[model samples]
Every structure is written in C-alpha cells, then in structure tokens.
Target: MEAYVVATACTKFEKKPNQTFKGLTEEVYLDLLREAELENGDLIGQAWFGNCGMGTFGQRNIRGQVCFTPLVNKKLFPERVGIINVEGGCATGSMAFHGAWKDVVSGIEDVSLAIGVEKIFQPDRPDMIQEIYDGGIDQFDKDEWIKFYKDVGDQLGKPFNPEEKKGTIFMNTYGLQALWHMKKFGTTQKQIALAASKNHFHGSLNEKAQYQFKVSVEDVLNDREISYPLTRSMCAPIGDGAAAALICSKKGLKLFTKEVQDRAIKIKSSVLTGGKYRTLDEPGLSRIAAQKAFKQADIIQKDIDILEIHDATSFCEIYQLEMLGFCDDGKGGQFVEEGKTSLDGELPVNLSGGLVSKGHPVGATGLSMVHELSVQLKGEGAKRQSKRHKYALAENGGGVIGFEEAACSVIILQSPF
Candidate 1:
C-alpha cells in the first residue's frame, strides 16, 4: 500500500497574526486543491490536523474542521472526516502527516488531509513567550523545576540562572546532549556557527523564509547566547504560518491529472516513535524510527538523496545526522565542516533553510519540511532545489521536557520512476 501527496501549500511566517487560522487554512487549501485540480467537494475524507498555539489563537478542538468547513459550504461529511489533533512541540506538523499517512495505508481511509498551522503572535511578547514555555513546562514542583533549569544553565555557562525565577525550567535538555557531543567529538562552536550560516544562506534564497538575510559563522558565534554554545542565530524563531498536504491512496490518485498521476511521489515509509525517557544516552525512538523507515522504504542510509531534519538548533541537526547513520557518532561536526550536508555536497540537508532560517511555527514546521521535500522532488523548489533528489527523508521531533522527545516522526518519500 502506497500513499502520495497530490497537493501542498504553505504560508509565510508573519510576526502578526494578519491571517486568522480560518483565513490562512482556507487560502492554503484553496491553492493546493487548485494546483491538484481537485474540487472542494472532492475532499470529503478524514483529516489529521496539527496545531500549536490553539489557546494562543483562541480556538477550540478540531481547529482544522472548524476553520475549513465553512470554505467548503459546511458540507463536510462528519462520518467521512474524522479529525485528530496532534501536539509534538515543534514537530506537530510532521506528526500530523504521519497520522494521515497511517490512515491511508491501513485502509481506514482512501484519502486524508494532513495540515499543520500555528499562530503564536499575541499582543505581548512576554505573554507569547509564556505560552511557548507553557507547552513544554511540566506540572511538577515549579520551584524544583526552576532550580533544575538554573543548574543546567549554570553548568552550560548561560548568564541567566532560571532557577531564581518561580516555575521556570529553562532547561533545553538538548543543550546538555550537544555539550556532550562537543566534549567527546571535539566539535567546536565555530562548526555549529557554520551550520547556522549555511541555513541562513539557503534561506536567503527562499521567498517564503521569514528571514532572508545571509549570516556569517562569526555572526552566529558572536550573537547573544541563549544557552551555552547556542546563540540567537542557533535558535529557531517563533512565528505564524500554515502548511497543508493532501495524501491519497493509489485508488484516489485516479481522480488527479495524468501529470500528477505519472509524477506521484510515493510514501515509502512513515514511522512515528516516542522517546525512551533516557537522558545522556542515544534516543531509542529516533534510532528505532529510522530503522523502521529504512526497512519499509527498502533503502539504506547511504541511499538517501536528501534530508530535512528538525534542526531547532544547529547541534540538533548535527546530532540527528549522526544518530540517523548519515555519519559516524562524534563525527557530525567534521561531516558538516567537510560540506557533506551542503547543497552541492554528497548528501544535501535542510535545503529549505530549516527551522533555523525558515521560521519554525511549531505545528507548521513539520508540514513545511514535507512541502520543501515534495517541491524539490517535483523540481518546483524554485530556488532551493538540490542537485539530485531521488529520495528524501524528513525527521521532526518535539516536546523536550527531559533528555528525550515527547513525540517524533520520520517519513521517507521517493520520486516515482
């Protein structure tokens, strides 16, 4: 059983919620459906929606249905459209896609829509920051959490000790993992800066990227430090955006055009796994998910043509590259320095600027990755197209409370021969 993406659309991240969830989603669906030449009435099947900032947007459950049903005359067949809400910190979008793909593959639905949208910009920056933190903040002893964050920060050399703040756990668990990698592999801050620089350079060429300016490694290194060895440039900016993709089975593909029919990109593998809650060790879910995807796709790591990783920070990208078997452990930094992940390198990665430069709208980030890969496969990636893309991989991780992710999804896509 195979599923293919027949249409896709995404909105640019804006500081203000100029477009409400309903407006943004309707626009994306209209555009994508138009491109696929599918009428609104054709989309009567189930849908998997991913969104962060629901509370921020003042929306209730099944946000996608509520936002899109009106556009299609409120005739959405309730029996046909089973809505599922997914929350995976920054990987919400990718998680939604995984859910939709599962439904189609399992014969639960012949066609399903996977959409990710987020609106974080509120009236106050502090309020928005609080909202973002609230998504990951554990409901344990608030003071203890704050103290733990402060200790983590102090150990990482961060200036602000969050432990002093009430109910604030500023621990970016990944920071500790990153520091470990640096200590063991001799990975330098300069190498991480280089990765950020590359992302910005690639992002500058993308019209949809929020930040279009090219940055230097020095700029990334010298920028204000959020965490030890992580500067502002190394972090992903929160913004507002939406991305949508229509997934359908082989039977449903007959409704599309011959061009789309002939150029379908099959879903070779889609794997979602949760973390093992183990700190200071390799993420079991990431490893297991990668293995499952590889086996399902019938391709090894060496055969992957391009990859879009959940690089919330430069180190995250490096770690995932190593963990996914793209390179040996402790050698990811050297791999980046060698230009192995560059556009012209042996394995191009994050060709669409990634979350670093692309603006991670949490829920929309995963779908954005899928959209970029699909565009690249179709030779429609305008400016960020890779040299060769026979197969593409996307890995999205979210909700970092401790050492492991709360949710993670890995998808393998291949251009049909």
Candidate 2:
C-alpha cells in the first residue's frame, strides 16, 4: 500500500493577469489527467487542493469546492470525489502532497490527486500582493515579531528600523538573517550573490521558469537592493501558476500503462513539522523535519543525489543547506561559493531555478519542487538533467515564526526506473 508518484504536471510559472481561477485550475487538471493517462477524472477517489489566495481575493469558506465545482459541473471532473482544501502559507502545496500520500499509504484510496494553484499577481492593486505576504506572519500579535527583530538588531550591533526597510517585511527578516550569518560564519555578500547567479543560470535552462535568462554574480550584486546585502535577484518573484501530481498505491499503479509504471517515483518518506519561538543558537524546523524524513526513509544525507529547497531568498538557500545537513552548520555559503552545489557538482541543488528564478506562487511553490524532482528522477529533465538520479530530496518551508518558518515539509523520493 505504499504511495508512488505516477504522474506530475506543472504550468509555466508567470504572471497571468488575464487568467481566471477556473481557467487556471482547468489547465492543470486536464494536464494531470493527460499525463496520468486517465480517460476521465472519475478514477480519482479523493483529492487535496492547495491554495492560499482565494480567501484574500474574497472567497473564504469551501475555497476548494468553489473553484473545483465548475469542472465537475462541466463533466470534466467527478462530482462524487471529495476534495480537501489546504493552506499553509508557502508550504501549502507540500502539505497537500503529504495528505494524499497518507491517504494512499493508509489504504483509504487507491488513487489520489494533489493540486496546488495560486493567483497573486494584480497590476491594478499592487497592495494585494503585500497583503498576501503579510499574512505569513502572525497577524494578531504582529508586534511580537517586530520586537523580536528589534532585539536581534541590538545584539548584532546593527539596529533595525521598520519604517526604513524596503520590500516586504519578510525580505527585511532575510536581510537581517544574512547579516547575522555574515558576522558569525564569515559568510560574504558575494557568496549569497553566487547562489543567485547559479540559480539564474539553472533557470535559463528551464523553459518553465519565470526568469529564463542567466545573470552574472556581478550583475546580481549590483541589482536593485531590496534589503541591505540582498538584491532583487536574490529574492523570489511574484507570480501565478498551478502544479498537480497523481499519487497512487501499488494496486492503483496497475491502472496505468507500462510506460508510466516504469517511470514511477516511490515516495520514500514525507514529514510535516511546526515551528516555535527559538533563540539564534537553535536549529530551525526544516532540520527537525528533515531528520524525521531521513530516518523514515532509512537513508542518510549522502544518499541524496539531487535536491530542491525553499530558497525564498538566496540567503535561505545557504541557511537551509546547513540546516538540512548538506554541510556543516555554517559552511553552506562556502559549499555554494566553491561550486559544489552547481549542476555539475557533487550534489546538484535547485535545478528548477528555485523560488528566486522559478517564480514562487506560494501555494504552488512546494509542488513545483515536487514536479522538478519527479522529472529529474524519471530522466526527463532535458537540458537540466543531472548525471545522478537514484534518490532526490525536496525541502519546503513556509511563513515565519520568531526566527524560522512556521511550517515545513521534507519529502524524499526514490526512482524505481
């Protein structure tokens, strides 16, 4: 009754102001069925839908039913299939995937679908994007985070000023985190830029990436500054897109052709964990989630052949490298700066351009990571394919707590082909 990802599909991550919610959902829905080689949606027993903006856009309750009922009415999807809504800040997609994996592993469903769709681009109302991001942090107790940042600033001898900060508050938080890492680990701004430049190059090779052009380290360093030591190129862009995956049990796999069965990617383990207020010395939630996932998968860090992380900011890529045990506590910067994490390196990271270049549509971001890993494992990555493909890992975190993400999900996948 183990779960396996039989098929995955992702639309180009970009800003689509003219696209309606129904159109966006339908696009990925049909693509998922097509890729899974299903004659109709009736084969799916249950579904988990990930989305984070419908409530902000005015639809609150039953967001999944509201957006999906139209397809069912059109006879494109099944009316009897139950749909579960999921929202976990940026980790929304990961959470949905976790839900479906459990559904199959528990023998409750033979075939389940996990879909993540989002629309956060609004040219008419620029503030809407900010509002969407602001919700990632605690709203009722906003002052808690503000005070936390202020106290950290004093300890680092770099006082913080909210009024003077540019970009989103999350950017400022990342900027401050970068400064702390620099002070403690001798990490340089150039190393952060190197990660950005590398991802930009990887993005250039991916046709579905939002920023499909390569950028140099020098150019990334000189790009418009969002927060000190963090440029625009180092941060994720605003976008809209949808991604879907069909997770099926061993019995369910019999329904697909031999071609799909040959390309199936086994779900080794999937772990979801929460965050809490912790001091600077403590490890973040991603590390905790990763340990549980690694144990469940019965594999160590070195067993991983490739990876995709939630690099919301280039600095996060560095921090997560250390937290995820890819390297020592403070050597993430050095690891990337030395080209050990490039496409040709020992452990190829973020082959999808990551959030920085791939475009992060919060709800869809996590599944997009899943989509990339599945493609590479199946040896279908095309220009971005890695030489190694036995095992792959994805680390996705979302929102913000005192000093880390409010939620995180670590998924380990193994290639059966």
Candidate 3:
C-alpha cells in the first residue's frame, strides 16, 4: 500500500502564553479534519502524538492518552483509535510522521494521523525553557561533552569559556562548529548572515511564521550575540505550536473528496538514521539519511524542487546544505551567499522561515516542515510559493550526541499535480 498526505494544518509558530497543550492539539486537529473534508475522526485508524516538554510539566506518562482522551470523551476523536506517544528531542514531529507513513505503507492501517504539539514558553518562569533544551543531551554523559567541547576549543585556539556561553550549550556547540568551518573552509560570518537574512525575508511572507519581518544581512550581523559568530537573529527562537498531517493509503484515499485527493502528495521515500560518535571529518547523520532517502525514492539530490531542513541556527542551514549534498562540502556557505537557496533561486529552502524564524517548537517543527511543503506542492503558498513543486524534501534532526544530532529523519514527497 502507498501512503499519501491528504491533509495538513499548522498553528502559528509563536509563544501563546495562555494556550495549553490540549488547545493547540485541538486547533490543528480540527483544522486538518476540515481540510480533508472529514466531519469527524472516525476514519483515523491510528495516531502518533509527538511532544517533548509535557513530561517536564508532570504529564510524563501516557501523554497521548491524556491529551486525546479528553476529545474522545467529548465525542471528537474516536474512542478506539490507537494513540502512541513519541519523542525524539527536536525531531519528535518527524518521528511521528514516519510512524504514520509506516502504518499506511506496511498495510497495517489504511489511514493514520500524526500530530505534534508543544508549549515550551513560560514568561514568568524563564528557567523552564533552559530545562527543556537541556534534555536534548545525554544526562549521564555531561562530563564527557564538557571535555569534548573544551578539547575542540583548545584545538581551535579558542579556549572554552562557560561565562561567554549564551542560550543553551547547544548554541555553544554550533558556535564551535561554525568557527571550525571558518578556519577549515574560509566560510565567512557574512555568508552565514546572508542565509539568516534570506530566511527572514521568506518569513516575512509567511503569516504563520513567528518572525514575520525581513531582516537585512547587516542587521543579522549586528543582532545580539548568542555565542561568538552567532547572533540572536540567526538562532531559532523558543516558542510553542502544533501541526498535524493526515496520511492515507490508496484504498483510504476514496474516503475523502476529489479536492483533497487531488492535492494529496505521495510519500516517495522516508528514511531515519541514528547518530554516532564520530570525528569532525565524518559525515553528519543527515547526510547518511539523505543518501538512503534519495536511493529509496530513485531520485538524485537535483530532483528536489523545494526543501525544509533542521535549521536550528543559520550555521546549521549552511552545514546542512553541504551534508544533504545540495552542494559540495565547504561550499554551503557560498551556495547561500550566491542566492542558490533563495525563494527565487535554484533550490528554494526553508520558505516557511525554517526553525530559525518559524519558531522551533521542537515537537511541531518537523510536521511544520511537512505542512509548508504540502502547501507549496498544492500551489497554496500564496506569496512564498516557488515555481518548482515536483519533489519536496524535509530533513529533521533531533538531540545532540557527541558533535552531531542523535537522530535524523529525511522524507521525500512527490507532487500529485
């Protein structure tokens, strides 16, 4: 059986101080059903719910049930739908999406739903934000990472300074990697700023984006420094949001209207790879995932018409451009600097502003990527839609193990048009 995305929806990626997790989930859920022209959730055979911080808020166990059971009791969701909770750090949404795709393709479920919701912003309790990100690293291996950063700093002639660190330690990690790339490939800070500026412009066109204003390259260079070479504008902001995708098999597609089926995108390939502890010379996990995904899809990197990557920082976009083989290693900086990934460039990337400006709600981010690509493929991206819309790719990474992401998922979708 082949799986297709018949419907998708996303809430604005912003901090909703008064919103609860249930509220976010409900918003996207109803919106998705409406998009699919389904009056109720009876057609959903299974569901995968992705979340990260509810555990910190004391909803540690049975998170999916806790959030969905209310709807079931209120007669919104079907009572018998099998709900599974998922977490993979920031890649939680991708993981959930992968699970639903598997359910349909494996002939286990004809229709499956994937939803990711998160509420990480706490205005009165700012420390809670730090606590959420801290969970991305190994808890027992703290000293090991500490020494690893110190060793890398010493090798680069920029000794580690805890006091100089800003945002999460992850920022420090990205800063160190950016610095190393600069030394090795002559990647300039200006190039990184250029990528940030481009995404900001793209964000300005996305009403659903958290930062919906264009930022100049010079402004990005002058923003508040988080870690050396990384400014606030270049980093993904902390926020809360929810997103959902409804996956249906060929047999299940008949349940929806022609309008929904016509716009449905085919899931050509989906690949997830685990992270490993390796040296800087080794390829990142996304590289490995992308290779497998392309091979599975029977398409090369050039076949991708649009892309959404895990751009947690501007440097991440540059690094991912290389890792995904869009450009050769050490040339990602030049690729963006030359406007190859701009909205009107060769390969439009992060037209939804990506994690940097789209707001990294962690759990919802990957599905948010799916939502944007689906919209573009359907020609529904009013302002930011690109001319090319045949194949769309999304690469989402989760956690940080060693010097790279602990888990990464790469998905390729083909346009129904």
All candidates: TM-score: 0.92, 0.98, 0.98
The C-alpha stretches of model 3 lying farther than 4 A from their native spots are 162-165
Q: What is the C-alpha lDDT of each candidate?
A: 0.78, 0.91, 0.92
Order of models, best lDDT first: 3, 2, 1
- Residue 233 in candidate 1 has what lDDT? 90
Scored against the true structure, residue 135 in model 2 reaches a CA lDDT of 81
User: lDDT tens digits, residues 1-417, model 3?
Assistant: 688999999999999989998889889999998999988898999999999999877899889888887789878799888899999999999999999999999999989999999999999986778778888998887788888889999988877764464788788888888999999999999999999999999999999999999999999999999987899999999899999999999999998898888888999998999987779778899999999999999999989999998989999999999999999999999999989999999999999998888899999999999999999998889989999999999999999987799999999999999
TM-score of 3: 0.98
- TM-score of candidate 1 on Cα atoms, chains taken together: 0.92
Clashes of each: 0, 0, 0
Estimate candidate 3's RMSD in Å.
Answer: 1.0
Give the candidates in order of TM-score, highest first. 3, 2, 1
Report lDDT (Cα) of residue 97, candidate 2. Answer: 98
Q: Could you tell me which 10 consecutive residues in candidate 3 have the lowest summed lDDT?
A: 157-166
Error of 2 at 100 (Å): 0.4
Against the true structure, candidate 3 has what lDDT?
0.92
Q: What's the CA error at residue 333 for candidate 3, in Å?
A: 0.6
